[model samples]
Target: MPRVVKPKDVRRAEVLDRALALFLERGYENVSLNDLLAVSGTSKGAFYHYFPSKEALVVALAQRSAGEAFEVLRPVFDQPGKNALERLNAGLAASYQVKLGMGVPEPIAAMRSLLMPENQALFRKIVTIWEDLFRPVLTEVITQGVREGVFDTFDPEGVGDMIQGFAASIQDYLVRMFDAADAKSRRKTIDDCVKRLKLYGIATDRILGLPDGATVVLERKQVEAMMTLFMPSRPAGSLP
Candidate 1:
């Protein structure tokens, strides 16, 4: 027979899931503990036991969501056979899928909110966690690509930052439009951005002349990593 689960565990998970949903649907300020209680069917005491306050709960929710996302993505980057660039591009694709699946809204909203003076230190801390995770792998890939004559010259760290900035902007746009049900258009924008990114700095010669599946393994690995790595944070801006 299967083992039975505890009620508190079930309640905690339910409360979190419901809270996450509400936070996503309504901006953080708009959603209340009472709202979560109504949706989760849990007592205030139970909610407090799991999450001390609304702000603390939201913070926990953000951290937990981001953590879950990372677990899903880390494997792609960790794959041994994949080359760096292939992983990078594939990561972008996987990221889009995760966003769609998780129903995440515009990330910039969260980023901006997290940047508020009150949250800035924590925001920076989380940003550092993120940078620590992606920077080494990304830098290694770019550095190796340069050494192997696979890429034209660019600073590895700078390139990494550029990629992150670019992806963040694209995600922000995707989420805002997602709320409008303009996913198709949002996807088109992403495709265009990818094409532009490839053209701007990536070696056209390497990609243009490569045989089919040359990049498949790495791309898949990247996509997997990105799926887990990227996710929504606190809502920063007011809703549109």
Candidate 2:
């Protein structure tokens, strides 16, 4: 029989799948183009066809990861009999949960692996991709909230943008928290970050003209859970 050929999309997906496995097993920055070729079983030309550059791979993986994340979150926007407020709450909670679960794990440890100092640029890239991807989802919910009189906003789109900004604001805090030098420093960083999250929750309520404590952007419990889930404390005397 003649050689069977895979469709372009199939081949592209295979490369990405292989890449994701490599990324998860060994952090993204550690995996070189040659490494990808060897593991993905694709030639340099073929890999370049799918990803023009290593950074291109980051973009592709970010898009795919963000897409996967949205799939998990899509249901929250379609729940039966859920009011705008209810959906907003559920949606926010679910989004955090999905992220904490590292569901696609940072649009593909696109978030988790980005934690290392070397992957800072890649981390920033994925964050932008995620914000852009999810902005419309939040806008829709905000618009609906306005329609149902659950949220008070004259410009839901702008509010949606602001929410994305607020969420992105935590990125630096998280980096600092994770990079803390010692147990005491880490504990302080965590506390400060968690407090900032709580404040953001309140700010969200104010933005929507709700009561002082209407929304819970990132609950303390959720923060703690995510911290434990994603970056557990290194064992004493363990390498960083």
Candidate 1 residue-wise lDDT at 233 = 29
In candidate 2, which residue ranges exceed 4 Å CA deviation?
1-4, 21-32, 102-110, 233-240
Residue 129, model 2, lDDT:
84
lDDT by candidate, in order shown = 0.54, 0.76
lDDT of 1: 0.54
| TM-score, structure 2 vs. true | 0.82
lDDT of 1 by residue, 1-240 (tens): 997656876767778778756655565556767898898876888778888887676666656655665676667656677666666556655655553444344553454345344454444445455555667666776676677666555677766666555544443433333343344553454455455444433443343233333332223233223322332321312111
The TM-score leader among the candidates is 2
**Candidate with the greatest lDDT versus the true structure:** 2
The deviation in Å at residue 189 for candidate 2 is 1.5
